[model samples]
Target chain A: MDDLDLDHESVYDGLLGGDSSQWAFGTDFEDPLAGVDTMIPAGVDGAALAAYCLMLGDDALIYAHRLSEWTSNAPDLEDDIALANIALDLLGQARLLLARAAAADASVVPQMPEGSPVPPEDALAFFRDEHAFRNMGYVEALNGDFAVTIVRLLLFSSHRLALLQRLATSVDPVLSAIAAKGVKEVTYHRDYAGRWFVTLAGGTEESRRRLVAGLRTVWPTYAELSRSTQVETLASEQRFGVDPAVLTEEVDAVVDHVLAMAALERPDLPPSGTGPMGRIGRHTEEMGHLLAEMQVVARAHPLGKW
Target chain B: MTTLAAGRTRAREIAGTVVDPEMPMLTLVDLGVLRDVTESEVGVSVTITPTYSGCPAMATMRDDLVHALSDAGYAEVEVKVSLSPAWSSDWITAEGRRKLRAHGLSAPGPSPTGPVQLSLAPVRRAIDCPRCGSADVRLTSEFGPTACKALYQCNDCLEPFEHVKEI
Candidate 1:
């Protein structure tokens, strides 16, 4: 009936573990994705691709984290599992991207000599400074209404699917393979979110208003996604990346179609010029808070295995 | 090859009953994430690719697999996680689909073939009504309660249903 009752009830139901005496959550020390191999594309600038993939990866990672926060808080039990599974799909993509970026040729490390060695997970978890991160602002923003979260997924997945579809044809085999796998999942995410937008917008008066408000909140951040950049140029030249500018037509078509179907008024938000420049070393305060929670358990007992 | 041969046979049997922690009606083997199982000199190793990176149940699934193996007296088990070859719902077996339908959920449709051709994207394929085996159905919502399914309403059966997407 109360807050603790709802929060702890699931844990107490022996769902997670038997007793409170040794109730340990998450990982103790062993890396779940350890022993996995990552294959960076050959002939491409690993640094540029790593940075670009990190941007996409971080977007999925942060948003997936946010979505998981909705567990048990959703409107129904089935919905809770649904959101959690969607979060998992994104999380899976993020993991692969991060792994690929981190495993780039030692050459991607600016200071590393040709023969120098780097542990993959260390390269992934510890090496990248804040200035090196490339995730767009759309993902790290605080949670809005459920409708808004669905809308955000819809928009982001649309863009990602476009990018992944192009990547599927990359000169690089590994990138092509990863893209092949990713495109399928993003398609589902986009379609699922689109369905929600239609229902909420067409369902009822209150639902329609909330759905519109959710769109406005996420629209401002959407601009940065389409902004042009040299990183995109590097990937495009290598024939291993999708150009942000090229994605515009695709992005616009989908967004316009979804909005009209929902019968929602589009926000006249100005396109953001702030661009990928800020994501390099700068970020919203939210990133720091998120990293703190995520890093704490891992850092606390480094190497302790469950 | 011998250990792998033996391990595969055992794994096929064990995984058949290892139901998805979330869906419960489907097994990880049916989902196709359980790639291989090998009996190493140290122990038996089970290789699995996660359907989602942050899937909370992954830890539970790992523990459950170990428990199931150990209970069967295959001690010294090691679970290896693989990510490169990502999971797709297309990997789900036909039997899995039937199980899902019997459990009152629609099965995944076939994967889209040929180029994506966005304008010609597949829509509203034949979905057997999970409740009454009716063929008449209409999609109520693309987004279902979960990420894997779409909400549909069966016209003949007059029941709303969840249809899994074939990724």
Candidate 2:
């Protein structure tokens, strides 16, 4: 039979045309909320809205970078692709949210050299210093192992999915649209992480031990995620955003169910209030390292275009 | 008739025939991503939506739209990606579903109209095998090679196939 008549043609065949080489990594980047009306609500403070978007956007950006670190390092090819896809999803969300933040308050996006063609979202992502980032402590924490990464993803995606579900109804149409699209992606992220949590927990003794240890290591950071800052609380009050604190119960329920299914005990660890609040542009030392690597190229060549 | 009005109709007809690069069997209209097509004195403008936030196919679709329109004598063509009233699996046309099944990929089931259940477990749903018309299929993986599909194995046919996931 001819190649055209093959029953199981490669999926890559569809991806082959139209300069496929340029399609790698960052080529497909586009403003997800491009055509949507991004008008800020009448009563909402622009700076406050920008700050809130930065908080969420920075979390996704930093976490996506960390996940991308697993590029060719995942245990299996499938997992490598899975983690990369998840990272891309978060990265896409980050691009839209950061662009929204920049649109709200130009000050949040760092200034570049004269005639810099870098987009605001790229500026916010690649130019911001560690202290300027507003991501939660858990996502910035170094990836310990596969189990640790999966546990962090489970908690983070769970909390995010719940929060996005409510944010989908925000008074700000742009935020609401971003959240509406985000809920579907985060749902998958949460489910993927939860399934891995159960599988690792119920696998061999070594895997179970690692999963428990990973959970214990990551549990203390959960408190920081649910902690609503002044801006977040104010935004939620004005119906511009969802309060992260309100999502605690829904997030906990999902985590609890997954842990139960895995036959694992919930770790009763104290909150790690080590660094300044992540909501207010303070992060762990590891975050600085992560940023250094992530921003090196952009900082070196401010006007360079990919 | 005004040139703009005539051009708009022609633009829509041209765009309607542009196939999804990934699912070559389905047109953008069949996949419900092509939201609107309009024409003006300057050029034609087309709006499309992504199947998922990170669907890589959007870039190809945009390029395809531009190429197809430009080749059709439209000097300037703009492809706008929208996310507001987000795309849903329910928007997949009935003809699109039939084409998908014919290609040996199970079509997406009816989307749940109510709020999605926030749970850890995979939401259980019955998926019939596209090859054998059997409901005895089990999901082997939540993800497939593409963002919008899942891997499933049919017990009756003993064949593994991809199923468009209902998002």
Candidate 3:
């Protein structure tokens, strides 16, 4: 029999060529933005641009961490694999954005010890305190039931899809390239969550009730996602960033259509304060727990090799 | 031909023939991922792009290129990854499309020229079954067993196959 004739049990087995030792989730890393001209655009504030990228990067990093929590806990096998793939995509985006932020301004990267081998992205992800993260509350909030996860994914993906589309045209080449690739990935993410959202909402009595309850649980934090911060405002004015506020109309239109199709109502909920606290290193109580779990391994073994 | 030019051409041919470990149906050249190969005073430099950002096949591809070039008697081989002007599904060569279908995976349809429309459902493209060449097929899942393909079942043939996803 030929070497390729070996019966493979899964796609990964085939993809890895029957040897899993060389394959790793994040270990075999290559610079995603390599060979791209990362020069900051003329007339843009380097510090503000880096800060803006931190916000975007932190959002993806935290949400990816939350999604990874579903690895062995997803409702089914397919959902398990799907959520893992989605998390990896977000992780890839976070890496690129964080790397870009460091390139734009090294000051934003957390201080690493001399001769430490940790990359800038890893440093930011593992070294930062809870109060240093800029992710919106929606991502850092504790995951509830399956319905709540679906609701959160739907809302986050929709908003992110709109924002990435606009950022695809940024004057900065690195940001534009990242957004160009992100647009496709986020489109799939939004569609995946939307499909699940409709399925549960239209499935049965229990599912419908859970879906409604999930919507109510997450609705209060929705306003925080679109609130623009001073750094974002400055970057947007300079065309280096897309203001989150500008994405509201597009986000609402997509969400409204989906809700109407699913026969679900837009939960009437009060906004959770109109502050840019999240962007300025203030986060929910859950953020501390999330960071503690995420940073434990790295903190215990600084410069550890996987 | 000069010795340098001949070495460069030979290196390109060796690198271009390295098969993608994941797909196995297409080589680097067929997929348009091998962007360019150049000869410098130091050695041969090969450039490639990834089909997806998180694609695990890139590391294998790079290693394969370096090994193949070294086996061809080229020294100081360098492989570089490029992301600007990111890869598109449209870059898959016509020959690559035929090979994918022969391997029981439907080739990706032409990518939409306009911007992607944000909708509730995934934008479904009409894909013929690779097994029966039947147009009667339905997407079973947006994601297939791998990141680059989607699962589809052919109603006419009653067989399930993978379709290379349009990015």
Candidate number with greatest TM-score: 3
Query: What is the lDDT for A57 in model 1?
Result: 71
lDDT accuracy of residue A254 in candidate 1 = 87
Looking at candidate 3 chain B, the ten consecutive residues that score lowest on lDDT are B115-124
Give TM-scores for every candidate, taking all chains together and pairing residue i with residue i.
Answer: 0.71, 0.88, 0.89
A115-189 per-residue lDDT for model 2 (tens digits): 676888999999887778888877888888999999999999988988898999988888888899888888878
Worst 10 residues of 2 chain B by lDDT: B115-124
Off-target runs (Cα >4 Å) in candidate 3 are: A1-29, B121-123, B156-158
lDDT of candidate 3 over B49-147, digit per residue (tens): 877766777777877787778777777888887776778888999999999999999988876568666556545677788898889888777776666
Tell me, what's the RMSD of every candidate? 7.5, 6.9, 6.3
Q: How much is A153 displaced in model 1, in angstroms?
A: 3.4
For candidate 3, chain B by itself scores a TM value of: 0.94
Ranking by TM-score: 3, 2, 1
**Pairs clashing in candidate 1?**
A82-B146, A92-B53, A131-A280, A131-A281
Clashing pairs in 2: none
Q: Between the candidate structures 2 and 3, which one is better when assessed by TM-score? A: 3
User: For candidate 3, what is the DockQ-based docking class?
Assistant: acceptable
TM match of model 3 to true structure: 0.89
Tens digits of lDDT, candidate 1, A47-87: 88777767677777777777888888987665677677778
* Native contacts recovered by model 2: 0.39
lDDT tens digits, residue span A190-279, model 3: 888998998898889999999999999998888888999888889889998999998998899888988998897788789876787878
